[model samples]
Target: MEKYIQEDLDKKIILLTGPRQTGKTTLSKMLNPDYDYFNFDNPDDRLGLQEKSWDRSKKLVIFNELHKLKNWKSWLKGVYDTEGIPPSILVTGSAKLDTYRKVGDSLAGRFFQFRLHPLDLKEIHNFLNPGNLEAELDKLLFSGGFPEPFLNGTTRFYNRWKKSHLDIILKQDLIDLENVQQIIQIETLIQLLKHRVGSPISYASLSQDLQCSDKTVKRWLMILENMYIIFKVPPFHKNIARAIQKAPKFYFYDTGQVIGEQGIKLENTVACAIQKEIHFREDCFGETKKLFYLRNKDKKEIDFCTTSGDDPVLMVEVKWKDNSLSSNFEVFRKFFPQLKMVQVVKELKKEKTFPNGAEIRTAHNWLSTLTLP
Candidate 1:
């Protein structure tokens, strides 16, 4: 079960959205188990929704993949308005529905929106038992947070699951939602991005490498992000002159997709863990939290930063060994006095202090201790 599932359902309707295969459907079923669950993917459910034949008098109703319908907004509004509070409603779908559910005025203030993500370190490990931290990280890095593959726990099963997941997203979901015609180019871009993880994205360089225009490259990147295949965090803007502008470092939602190298997968794993913490704060408690990268014209960089608007709350850097703070981070701390500095590393160390007073800890300890409020 996900922490987001525990959020209070005070609104008339709740909209649950997230990347594909992140267990949105499973959670929805958990929410309204005894009620008649309607998934639009099923032909019978589609016909029922089209004809308004489903039981409206039920105490609770769950609409799965409801956003796929053309007039999902209008239909939802009609039902929500006419039915009042007798039949509580829950709407679940991929990230595709996230936009339609939030932007349209018809659904405004009517539903609470939440984004479900793949599993993270804290979800898999018992914080009380730090004894097996090494083994836990190895397993999570090898098998991504997606429930199916993570639970299977075998190389053969993981590979087969990854191929099937990508095929469905690249060949079907992208086509159905984005109406993207350059399937081959986008697919190539996604493959290339796997190598570019934990680094700043250069559209101009990618365009030249792929023999496509910069605009095309950016469009493909955006499409992949919308599909939740990847995510990007922009540079911090607290100090404009020192911070790099408009440059975002991308990370995959699932680290298992990164083929052989454990370094990038390690960084990507930490990124996802931090992302889960911040997004939960936003979706569950309505807090303004964001993740970002810190770098300046000097080329000195830190892996990740947590912020709320212009205020930098925490600065995080991921490392595989040593667990020692870098000089670049010392300079970053001197510059941003308000932000708390933390170094998350693969190797656990007795909370060591840097020359500039930064703290270092293992990824397992840092992630396991985080709470939304």
Candidate 2:
């Protein structure tokens, strides 16, 4: 398997974070072939790293899932400060290292953070064939980009893999990372969230369903988000002060995970893949681009908003089936007259420029055209 060369390899310390089974460990091994590997998942390996913190060898070091340890940040800071920077350090984890609640003021400005999302269209194209976009999209949406399940090429195998993966994350990862007293509540919250994808999350409603307080619901949601089990995309509102502010649309990190757990149609699965690709691109390349969903008081919605600085470079509406532009486009054009609008369809004949000056393009073509600026 070809490793996607990350851009920030030369930085002092690189923290690679993503949801479980996104190939973080595999990528770390490939990044530093000569590094001494230590994973907290193994009791012996964890004990070794804890006992030998002062051994300042010059060889590269790769720490896997060490963020679960309470003193990991401080320990790494001491190791790096005393070792004189000869050994490059790479830390890979399933959760966001910076989001650990017990993390102290250490290792700041000493590391560059990079998030590794599941394989996108570009990465798959580079690895496989660039021309096989439709097949790749179909395979990725159905089987997901988790290396093991996708390679296995059977729905039963993928479903079993997803169940086992979810169990480990819920049972082991959460318990190791957080100091929660009610593990069952957190597990139930996660299961409930799978049904709320693409819907605005209400804290009060969630709290009521879980028989917990609003604050507890919020905290647990943050924990789940930090662990990359789920994430929220805020709505785009510039000048509209009265626009809805408290609610955010939620999505799982991987669409296949959601599909395997809940049954989503092929069309909805495709939409989720496209959404993940847009968000991943924006996050990986910051300042140059932004991705958000659009909503207004008049009950209009757009699937995605991609912008370059203040100017809206593109406004996109995704539909599973062939549908005409909703009146919402007219309202949006009234506000941002200069921005280009587009409609992305799962099934379309190439790209078409509508008579109303909007572009109608296949999702695969549009995603392939996007490049980091």
Candidate 3:
């Protein structure tokens, strides 16, 4: 994580944006603990910032939560345009700093944004080696990837952390961002989405279940997306026939929050794993990468499809314990001859290559091998 941040801070103003408690501030502070630091959320600190005093000798400065300020874009434009690069600037925030910073004046070329995903196999271990991956993989699945609980490694701690995390995302984060009359309703919608994890999401069914218009349900989902509580991937159909393209599958940003069975739980875990790689690519390296799933009108489906620009490059399927190739895997291989296929099964006893030369490996080993372009 430090390497990723350090790689960009030298050349561009850096914004560390991701879900809450994903260690954006912690990582930022580690870069230069001696640097001048300000948090916009703190009224007293902001008051100090209002004075615009500067330590002329300082080589680094950190501004946290400044995105909440109305004129942050304009203010940053001045600080950056005036100060130049003596004090290399770093901005940190939770929830959509990536989107919010672009709101007012265009700070377009001023900053390089890197999404700090929760701790994962690659971040935690020697990803290339991944020695003794089983224990680490189980711990990741049980504890989820947020810093505190992941470090504490206790069910009791995770339970408390999970409760408090939800409260903050809902009561503090969501309330700050949107003014909706139904807080409890949105909370219920979060739980409903938890159940819908690893399954195709039908907005109409969700709307009917919640007794709200389909549009309202869609809006709520969007709210969750913006808040970083959940993220989704769409269906893939670029060259497929009779493809199901409308539906999406949602996955929690933290897999530990899901109460589903292990099969679905691992599916969400894998989704988050792949997503971390995707974000690192798009956010850090400026790659045109995306995650999607494959399904057809005839009900054939694969768990995920990854793309580079308009072309499909990889297809994945998740099975609880099965090591054999799936039908949809072959379907995608036949349709897209160049697509790389990976089959992840938790109980895979050994890494194997299928007849078509696709790899089947344990989730832990496979996830550890992923890297950004």
Evaluated with lDDT, which candidate comes out highest?
A: 3
TM-score of each: 0.91, 0.86, 0.93
Cα deviation in Å at residue 47, candidate 1? 0.3
Tell me the tens digit of each residue's lDDT in model 3 across 1-373: 5787777776788888889899888888788756888888788778867887756467778888787777788888888888788677888888677566436777889888888888888777763354567777787788888879987889999999999998987887666666676889898888898888978899899988889998899999887887788998888877445344387889988889887788888898888988988887887667898899987778898898899987888888888898678878776677788888888888887888877868888888787777522
Error of 2 at 155 (Å): 0.5
Distance (Å) between predicted and true CA of 142, model 2?
2.1
Q: Which is the leading candidate under TM-score?
A: 3
Per-residue alpha-carbon lDDT of model 2 for 254-348, expressed as tens digits? 66755333224333353445555555554454445555677777768776666777666667776655656556677888877876787767676
Task: Score residue 89 of candidate 1 by CA lDDT.
Answer: 80
Q: Candidate 3, 92: how far from true, in Å?
A: 0.6
Q: After superposition, how far is residue 208 of candidate 1 from its true place, in Å?
A: 1.9
Clashing residue pairs in candidate 3, if any?
none
Question: Model 2 clash tally?
Answer: 0
Cα-based lDDT at residue 31, candidate 1? 67
What is the Å distance of residue 357 in model 2 from its true position? 4.5
Clashes of each: 0, 0, 0
Residue 160, candidate 2: Cα error in Å is 0.5
Looking at model 1, report the run of 10 residues with the lowest lDDT sum. 1-10
**Candidate 2 regions with alpha-carbon error over 4 angstroms:** 1-10, 53-59, 101-103, 239-244, 259-289, 355-357
